[model samples]
Target: MSTETVNPVTGKIDEQALVTKANRQDLRFAIIGFVVLVVVMATLFALVLDFMIDGVPRISGEFLTNYPSRRPEQAGILSAWVGTTLVMSATAMLAIPIGVAAGVYLEEYAPKNWLTDIIEINVTNLAGVPSIIYGLLALGLFVQIFRLGQTILVAGMTLALLILPIIIVATREALRSIPLETREAAFGLGADKWQAVWMYLLPAGRPGILTGVIVGMSRAIGETAPIITIGALTFIAFLPPAPLQDTFPFVNFDWLNSPYTVMPIQMFNWISRPQAGFHVAAAATGVILLSMTLLMNGLAIYIRYRIRRSSR
Candidate 1:
């Protein structure tokens, strides 16, 4: 009995040696990948830590309540943060339903054809298109043609367009991840396509869908070029009209048409100033923006976990 795994035709060791060689290659690839990941993560961590060290002490009660001013110490992000919130609310409202519906239709309902293929290709390409392009488009379509002005509504619509491709791609990919067997099982249970998708597939894919939504929003929140191009004020002294009115309906849509500025633009304004105090203010704004992004991602993770646990 021979111990070696020999190829009888070649009369040499073959299977065993090949298997050992392949395993070694795999191990080497994994080790290299891990090292690269660690290096990238460490670099990012260092940058964020530096920001926190410089900015954390500068954040004070007044900083959150006051508006921008020539005196950096007196200037605050009150208007910037409020504008960011309202614009993000509008972006999410517009982007989520439209993007998700487009994705679902293309993935499950649309027939496989050249038109669908072209649509999918364009969508994937759009995800990689520069953010400035969306800004330009918004300037033409929303600002000039539609006469929406460079208001909060226009900014929101611009960002919604920028992130639409991301949500759509994420949605289609998430749905595609569902096992064919799962779909068959749903059909076997006498559920129609729409019923199965709504009742089962969508639920199963919710976590991934939510993850995509959060990621798109995170990108949208940090975007400056589109907002700047859309003429977001660099130094807004006043806040938009309050969404909650004191009388009548109690809720008003007046803020949508009001001029606005977001955190990134505010930070940019500070950074471009010659004063060191303004630089410090910029760093502080960065910290707040980063915190907001992390909070959104954390909330998404928590929601996804709850959904998965409940399903199980």
Candidate 2:
């Protein structure tokens, strides 16, 4: 058999030489990949070590509960963390359902027409738009027009808009991954459209949907520009309203209108301050933020694995 290449200098087919060359190419690619992996691992290791050295000492109960103060030693992240949690919770609640519903409609129900084409194009375009633009849009529509003010509700809603396109795209892609025969089989079994979607499609698509949601949320948690543009206070000394009330109506929404700050905002404020202690505190806060993001990603992976196993 002839080899893949002939020697240009000798003008002869050399099968052994060609095989050696192919092996070398493969080896070189593998070596490059290994180097890249090593570099990434080293970077993460360095970051973790730095945080531990500078931040661990400051990670006390007092630091967790104390409010922001002019003194670096007295400042804490209570309001910042609480605000982050509340805002993220609200964002997830608003974005996930709406985004998934829109995705389902686009993928399973919408007609293949110019209108749908326009919508698809817009959705894709929206995903790439600068986050600050979404902030501006939220500022104009939610804050200025609707008069929501600079509050947790407005911030959560803004972040929801930021991640909506991502979730929708992920949902559509997940739905597409299901084999067409599966849907056909469901229909053959006398399943209606809603039944087919809810019973067969959504469950199979859950892994991808969950992956998208967590990834989008990671981005939301790190966002600072949009939140700042919407006037989130960097120094939120007071906690927002409580979820429960002692009065007649048990639930309270007053927190939605209160001022808030998130981890990123808190870190920003600390890093910008003229104090070494504050800088260390910022590093500690980063460790917390990183931990949260990693935890979310791990959960997504676990859930996805379970879904795949169940499907199998």
Candidate 3:
């Protein structure tokens, strides 16, 4: 039997070897270019980073865990650490349900029609929009729309909106990757749509969901504009209070309304200063942020591997 290539535009059969040679060439160039870019970027970063740490104490346990200080040689990123964690966790809490649910509705239940197509296009477009725009949205709407105040809650909700599309798209792709046979099997067993999607498909797609959630959270964590726009503080003397509590011992709802700060903002604020010590602190902060992102990515991969291996 002869192969045929269907022209997408002309709707004519035209069997071609385009996907073969073009794909190989594209992959070759992409890998080469990416390697070159990484090398050049790393070299430049190393050169400049030398200036930032020429003569500064690069290690101290106190510096790692204590709160920031006006004193150049004495400050730490403890508060910012806790604050970033709080903001990110809060963002995840807000984003996961909405994003995953949207993905579920679109992937598992939506009809193959114009409406679903439009929604899919919109989601892709939203993902491409600049992150700072979402920051502005948080500033304008969350701060002013319903008067949520400039708090972690509002900042998180804003970031949730910003990254929800990404999560949805990733989840949808993951869901689509599920073997069609599995869905049919579930259906044949009298499983409802919801059950097939959630109980079965979702568990199967956990790796992808986790991957998406972690990536989205990383973006939210690194974001400074929206939080700054929503009035993230540079100084907070205390850790964030628990989400729900009146007055047990040390927990309170003060974090929702009070001024807060996060890792990126802290790094930004410190790096902007004129002191060498602040610059070193900035470098340390960079390492911390990098470590966090890498750790999350690694954990996600590990979990995915474990899950896939077990499922086999």
Top of the candidates by TM-score:
2
lDDT (Cα atoms) of all candidates against the true structure: 0.90, 0.90, 0.80
The per-residue C-alpha lDDT of model 3 at residue 83 equals 78
Q: Each model's TM-score, in the order given? A: 0.83, 0.87, 0.79
Off by over 4 Å in 3: 1-59, 242-254, 301-312
Model 2, span 190-294: residue lDDT tens: 999889999999988988998889988988998888998898898878899897899979998888888899999999889998889899889888888888887
Worst 10 residues of 3 by lDDT: 50-59
Write the residue-wise lDDT of candidate 3 on 83-130 in tens digits. 787777778888999999999899888999999999989998999988
RMSD of each: 5.7, 3.5, 8.9
Candidate 1 local Cα displacement, residue 21, angstroms: 15
Query: On a 0 to 1 TM-score scale, where does candidate 2 land against the true structure?
Result: 0.87
What ranking of all candidate models by TM-score puts the best one first? 2, 1, 3
Clashing pairs in 3: 5-14, 5-15
Candidate 2 collision pairs: none
